[model samples]
Target: MAKIEPGNGLKSAESRKSLRGTTESLALTDGEGNLFGSDSELNVYTSERQTDKYGFIGGAQQYSEQSAENIPPEVLRQREAKWLDMLNNWDKWMAKRHKKMKLRCQKGIPPSLRGRAWLYLSGGKVKREQHKGKFEELDSQAGDPKWVDVIERDLHRQFPFHEMFVARGGHGQQDLYRVLKAYTLHRPEEGYCQAQAPIAAVLLMHMPAEDAFWGLVQICEKYLPGYYSAGLEAIQLDGEILFTLLKRVSPLAHRHLKKHKLDPILYMTEWFMCAFSRTLPWVSVLRVWDMFLCEGVKIIFRVGLVLLKCMLGSQDKLKTCQGQYETMELLKTIDTRYMQEGFLVREILELPVSERDIEKEHLASVRRWKETRGELHCKSLPRMHGAKAIMAAEPPSRQDLRQNPTIIVESPLATKSNGEDKERKNTKEQKNGKKNSSPTPVAAYLEPSEPSPLLKDAALLGSNQSLSSAEYDTYL
Candidate 1:
């Protein structure tokens, strides 16, 4: 993947750049002087701040790739071998041998297989095929002016010190722009969210612009819907759910948070919203995302619980965090040990938070909030979560994916057209059957009800694209 000239890539693959009127700081002008894009995977560049392969700056005690590096080479080889086997038989593993897949995900998807594995786990490949050339079409079209400016300004800020983004308008940033702009075009209503950038950047690191774009769609729509939308109603609900689950995981941390009146959102907004791409160490971040893409949002809640437990779980640890401010400061400067892959993954597995627990908690939180703050700000309820819901809600057949569903937004407060009214009746009937079905105590909260897709597939979607069998087996 040769890096094209900074502005050249944008002009060819994305929109032309203009000097923005806003005075927002650009990461392109970092003190090391501008770096030209290169063909090398690791474009070594001198930096005033400490630079590692994963590109954590500012002398953070922990390096981004430290966790994977610490793994014994023999062990890595074994994991890679297992991943290769699993990748070759993905559908079989996903359906019949899910435990084997989960065990491997818990162990951590080998870095070499990360992107390809993610495409499969996230069902992004299916989405890309469904949409076809939609990305290219969106890329060529001029984006919404409002989103374009903000996206450009934020582009330089995303992993700016990293080799890929060091240039002013390099291929890295150019690709990032294409993904974000394509997203805005894909779902004009959800628009762009600031947290989506780094998440996109991380995906772009592993895959191409189109795959990355589809990966972002899965994260925003299937895995964590309503999270990146207007008002963040879904995250607010999850925040309450996290707090509720926290009580069982770490009572000390839970009690302290409640006593200090610390809203989970205050500390967790960045963590959960960014999917911990911004918080955890790079290797740990990748591990978390691997499991997250595999299992859905449960990985997120478990990660949050693990962090709170480590940071404030003990009386001794809470000595400094007696108040909200102190606890926040500690959260901001999390101990490196907590971010290590070995410790974090182990903790996540040990914690008993399940999809059922989350759904039950989600329903409770929604009802309680409806009474207090009124209904969700958005016109719809929160989506069903976890991997099962994602697969169920998203059609299994490529035929279904190709056929874009007619999306009719419904709200008690909003009026509906006659056609949309008919659609609403159909939707209600679906709800009455499976949507309102009673949940058993164990699997009850899967939010098994069909969720309105936050990012709808449109008529102007992509052209058919297929993943090569060999490429699917190995990212290399």
Candidate 2:
């Protein structure tokens, strides 16, 4: 066997070859801070590589003479300039893209570069410039009634889990409401949908109001097509496809899951609703979004597939459980932090496609599956085959996934039993967050002489002041 140097040298020849194509060296400086390579040497190296990689089919001089290509003279000139710039910064750009993926935008994409970076990834630089003025134009418009109504329905229901992070009357909530209401007025056809809140909130961390709104617009119109329809057509389509992909990636887990009547729909609904809000940590979700912008909707599927692969290892540990609920109990305990850290964009690219070798084929199959399901030609649905819950008559909506600011109040009751039952329910809710439907709970069974905090708050908000003691107990 040949001896090998372990620390900085190649472990194997294959590893060296793999790195050769995509990797480049950092610029070397001598002890006295002098550059190593001259421009001529750098130019020669680049010219040879470009010829090998992007294959020149014709000579530029020959093409210039014979061209009836209808290409704009400016476009050709701009293309040449871009090629020169790329050659100049080839190593730096690749290094940055790699470093970006590793660092994972936790502190958020830098402010100044955010717009340009987003534009580059989504190929919307030119389009963004064309419509940049629209932000000011749209800001002058009145708020949409539809958005008001939709916002009303879900505002109180926002942030129903943690009191430390409630959405009630905060600056974040105010900004969210303003942008969402504004966008609804601006684009009446799309109006306001649910998932935009978190996306907007995330954007707001780095950008200003109008900028975040436009970013939201870009994500909605360009990226997540048909995501917020009344029928929830896009979410259901993605859900089915995720289930199919999940089954293939982990056969044993899939078998166990199926046997226990599990499906992706139950747990994975969060993945689609808030786009990984409740599933992954906030940092990981941001990391996923970085790729999501660059790669488009396909990254959603790729991330979902990776998540399912992560979920697979627990199935065996869950096999000895008593029932589906126990299996779910176990599944919920599966740590996702490792998967989120381990699976980078490069690893996602390398994930084995169980159905087809080509990405286009996988996407086409998913699209076809969605269309067929839409046509209702494939009406015979198989029973769930894993440890999962069947979604209720109404699946989780996009709005339910975001935090909003609204309040819920209970009505007064005459009957003693009804009043007592209502009070217990309200007390529980006051401790935890509000229910998805209601804002705050009422303490209905307070003593006749006692004053209630809710009643005091309601009174401050300009409600009726006069009430008898007996009725006041019910009202509070």
Candidate 3:
């Protein structure tokens, strides 16, 4: 018998070839050297391997293949040069060209720069730097048993068709588990929500574990606060807001949906909660996400409205759907063929819906929510287990402080109708006894009396300075 030393180098090409042949032969063996499986099994495994290599199995593959083909080289070069400039002079660019940044994002973030762009746009890098080593700490420690099982159950369900999460105990699944588990430990009050799984999965595809985790945090906290809380009041409120917007944008479709007893709750829940990851095609979903990070939650409402119009805008299509089930099926499985990413994004941008429109509706909807269910508080939730005392002692981050600075009320509430002007003038008179008022409407929902601090935080984070009604409106 040959003496085989473990880790000894194969001295020649012939030796390596022999080793390869031996390994291949062993793959066909059943304990001994005889083949154990049928040729069909071997062929099926080989075919799957080929598919994994070349076919678009999931979002990552689909995005890479399609994005490469769709983005012209000249456009890519122009966008890349612009992205480099923005990143190099981030502060200046952000301060001076913020509106221009929104337009660039709407055009579509180049694939090469998307990860870094997203980190900057969501302020994820700042948050990650602030919380260095925190993820590892939470990851090493055992998570609360309460959320462990729930997280585990939903782990495989997210992007299961994707190569990253296809296998049990795969690297992608493990990373997802760690991220979600760490979040539960980080914010035990919110716990784990099913919708967050897909959102995190999408982030993980673009960035590393730590960055992905913080991006998820920014999303839950700043972009759509109260959305994943115990009551899910944000989602419920947004559903009403969506219905209201639908009435304005497409009254016929809205009426058709309403007539069938279909509410935004039934169709728009997953759309808003997961940021359309579950509903839109992966390509369109990525496009939406690119804008969502830069522009905040307004993109979500825009995409939702566009989808509703696509599905139910046409009387012919609406007539084909008989009831709620049929309508939902149509909405859920929209024909991606017609709704190509570029077309859908264009439609969203062209839609006359403005930030002010969404903000006004959101405020009214939130008030309605509070009236029915009392005030919902984010601070009422418990802090992380061991970090509570430290969190109390530690001073707030500059970002956090900036987010909560003294509110500077803008004057002269902007009004479209005489009734609204009268209402605002009366409110202004009651508060300050003034006749002349600013044109921008006061987002009274943002007043301190509201229990959702996260909503206020969102308004602040979206702006460079103190939170004002105008900046708050930009959040949509």
Candidate 4:
């Protein structure tokens, strides 16, 4: 047989080539390296017998190549549409992503995009880096000495003050301070608000200083307007707003509150001032913040309503403890479970939409108040943001305070006794970290049935009465 050439061909041809080539190679070998060359009758007959034997492997490769080249048209079309949609409508997608990022401030945004996403969503994303440099440059030459002093004073008092806050930081206080100082440098206008400190600390857990500063700016300017204001009116307005919402939703609770002379403002002031950081468990506050970012400031009312409603409804068989201090200890111990069940987290979750309704109702109510009080309502009063004028003039008697469900304003006569004494005592204890013999059991005295009559009536008392820290400070 003639020698065969090796080349890319089907199996039948290759097999023939193999046989001829075998013979040639055998002929060239030495005796020691023996090779089989003699072809028997079965060889030539069988070689010619199977021409199509190799077709299967060739067919498989061809089919595979064809499938790769010609991917299904619909799948390709769908993928192209998705890519085009992403390209054309990227901003919309980005906005939704940014909103999600804001809500997850506790977990922090991804480290890589943290700065960009924060600034962009706040409408500063594009200029965040540039603005940071500019602010730093300005801060070196332009920050006020007074602002720096104020910022320094407040830096440590911000986050992790309670055990609730301390649990959040794996990093020591030093890292938290550096981020806070850097932020104070970045946004000098805000300088450093009280609530910003805690919020910034939380942001630092997940972001760099610059991003945290801008995030603080967004919080102050966009989410909480009053917090940044010189007078701190936003918190006051919110307190007034919470009072109004409670009255509308739970009138029975409102009456009980009025009778006892308990001021919703007293307890909730801390809540609004601190954004619930000091009020609820730290994690619960973060959960509220998640909704806050998406929904805005009105979540404050939802939280307040839920809390007040919880306190009111659950006091049915509440056992009385000892004096005011014991009463307060008992009040503080009320479990949150029942309160949570009735006030739907899902409903609260939907409050960004609910807030629109609240804002509209709020605006209308303001208009109605003005219309009804036309001549008596002075320009200064509406702007004053005082709770006294908004509430009823007289405080409830100890008995009236018990029967009414609404929280009441205290009357002038009720505080003739030593109500301010308890306030002073508590203030001293708070300052010294010593438990005073006399507890200003405001929480205990604020019986769900008996609204703190002193609070409702206190509005009518002369200006000579002593004030709490929150009273003169105005923000809380």
Best by lDDT: 1
Q: Write the per-residue lDDT of candidate 2 for residues 77-101, one digit (tens) a residue.
A: 5544443343233234333543443
- Cα error, residue 412 of model 1, in Å, equals 66
Put down candidate 3 lDDT per residue, 365-443, tens digits, no spaces: 7687678767765433221111112223343354531222224332223212445866767787889866655554443
lDDT of each candidate versus the true structure: 0.70, 0.46, 0.65, 0.43
lDDT of 4: 0.43
- By TM-score, the candidates rank as 1, 3, 2, 4
Which runs of model 4 end up more than 4 angstroms from their true locations? Answer: 1-90, 94-132, 138-142, 161-191, 314-344, 350-353, 364-476
> Tens digit of lDDT per residue, candidate 1, span 1-476?
11223212112212111211132454333333553344231234434456565544432323655554477889988998787677565555666888778778877887667777787788787788777888889989999999898888788777765656656688889889999999999999988887888889988877778889999988888788887776666776888899899899889999998887777766777788789987777778888887888788999999999998898989899998777678778988899888888889889988898888988898898899899878676754345454445665664563422312212333222323444655666679798774534422211111111234343432323223333322333343
Best by TM-score: 1
Ranked by TM-score, the better of candidates 2 and 4 is 2
Question: What lDDT score is found at residue 261 in candidate 3?
Answer: 70
Task: Extract clashing residue pairs from model 1.
Answer: 6-169, 131-462, 132-462, 132-463, 133-462, 133-463, 134-462
Report how far residue 36 has shifted in candidate 2, in Å: 63
Clashing pairs in 3: 411-438, 412-437, 412-438, 412-439, 413-438, 413-439, 414-439, 414-440
TM-score of 2: 0.49
- Regions of candidate 1 where Cα sits further than 4 Å from its true position: 1-69, 379-388, 395-474
Each candidate structure's TM-score, on Cα atoms with residue i matched to residue i, is 0.73, 0.49, 0.68, 0.47
Which 10-residue window of candidate 1 scores lowest in summed lDDT? 440-449
Clashes of 2: 11
Off by over 4 Å in 3: 1-69, 377-476
Global local distance difference test of model 3: 0.65
